[model samples]
Target: MKTTSSLSRILILVSALLMVSAYFTPLWQISLWAPQYPEGLNMKIWIDRLSGDVDIINGVNHYIGMKHIGQEMFPELQYLVYVFGAIIAFGVLAAILAKRWALYTYLLLLLILGLGVLVDMYLWGYDYGHNLDPSAAIKVPGMAYQPPLIGYKELLNFLAYSGPDTGGWILGASVLLAGLASFREFRAK
Candidate 1:
């Protein structure tokens, strides 16, 4: 009978546990700073909702013609909970089954899901930044307010910083652990 390595099993289990953190913590965060508001405005994006200064952010966005920020606006919020649950379930199964292919499949799915999220976020940002209403109050002749995918961007006087938050880092660590397990498994074979 073939058996999986103890390290691989442990890593998969740990990864599964870490993924649970995503549900409770914000996955991404964007902060805007200007001279007028020294403390800055923050927006946290979770798998299912938005938090932190949402009303203020929406008010500012209105002038620039960006869509009002709201949980109802995101369709993904409806299904992401189930998706993460499934990922966690699959990770646990992969560990318990101790099958190489099972772990590989989980890792592959995780990678695809991760990429999909980035694409979705970019599209969302693109739509908000580019589809400005003709009558917007704060129109710059050729300016778009698209937030950076993973860094800093300047929108007029505001400096926007975008990056993965705590949950995002956890998810990333989960993936890394899974990857390391896969690598070790492959090397052992």
Candidate 2:
């Protein structure tokens, strides 16, 4: 029983570390590294250079949108949903199982921050992806409308510092707290 308790604590601690480390390392960087933009523009660029089609207009924005997300300032990405979801799931479990107020506090903070991030991302998508109807384009011609996949960029960057360490620290800390809570729960059992 003691071993189980200790093991649960260890597991919870590990979970916390993973969730928290995610903030610093940002697992999404996995998506960022050699980001796959829409239609693989890097490859296209290479092919175009070879074929001398560089001047020929391409669906650059759409291609860019589909290929990678982080390069553009305020890039629209729906992927944030998954991140936020993970955060929430961890937070909720911690909240229900955790007896400590500090853990609850972390959960609250996650909720608040998570909601703000979600809203911002949704709006970014709404603004960036709004392609107009062809008929509307003829009459109310305006900025080219982007599809949803290419439009929603998550916007919860820490105001203090936008670097990996800054955001990662906060996110990591949150995960750590969550893991602690889970460990505590397991320990209780």
Candidate 3:
């Protein structure tokens, strides 16, 4: 088996360490603006919790029949930390082994994990927006208030924006580093 270069191993270790910081920062953010609240309302999605104007956002969402926004609503938060921990551990193991195949496998895992996250978020948003209470106070026929996945969306009177947060950027960087490491290793021969 071909061995990865020392630099590739170092990069893999660094990528694993970078992923650790994701646990300490918010992974995603959503902001809402409306005529009633020009100041805007924001929500930050942390690894295991939610922050920012959660109560206010929930109150607004209630009028539209959307479920209350709460940490308890997201069961994924319970195991997200462990999932990342396992991925990071795998990266470390790949680095220690210093094998090209292992590094490539780590890179593939990162890509799949990233894609899975996006898909999961999209599905959650779809369910949250589409499954409205029948007796909602402000029901508009055939209207679903799904927030944009990565940009701005006008939901009734509210302008909603969704995007990655600090932790997300760090995770992207880790993936980039891992990819670079894999590329370097592949070309080393």
Q: Give the top-scoring candidate (TM-score).
A: 1
Error of 3 at 102 (Å): 1.4
Check candidate 1 and list the clashing pairs: none
Tens-place lDDT digits, model 2, residues 26-141: 32111111123322222111100111112221233333232223324243233543555565566445434434443544445565664565465447546654532344312323
lDDT of 3 by residue, 78-163 (tens): 99999899999999999999988889999998999899989988998999999999899999999999888999999999999999
lDDT of 3 at 158: 94
Candidate lDDT values, in order: 0.91, 0.38, 0.93
Candidate 3 has a TM-score of 0.96
Q: How does candidate 1 score on lDDT?
A: 0.91
Q: What are the runs in model 1 whose C-alpha is more than 4 Å off? A: none
User: Lowest summed-lDDT stretch of 10 residues in model 1?
Assistant: 1-10
Better of 1 and 3 by TM-score: 1
Give each model a TM-score: 0.97, 0.36, 0.96
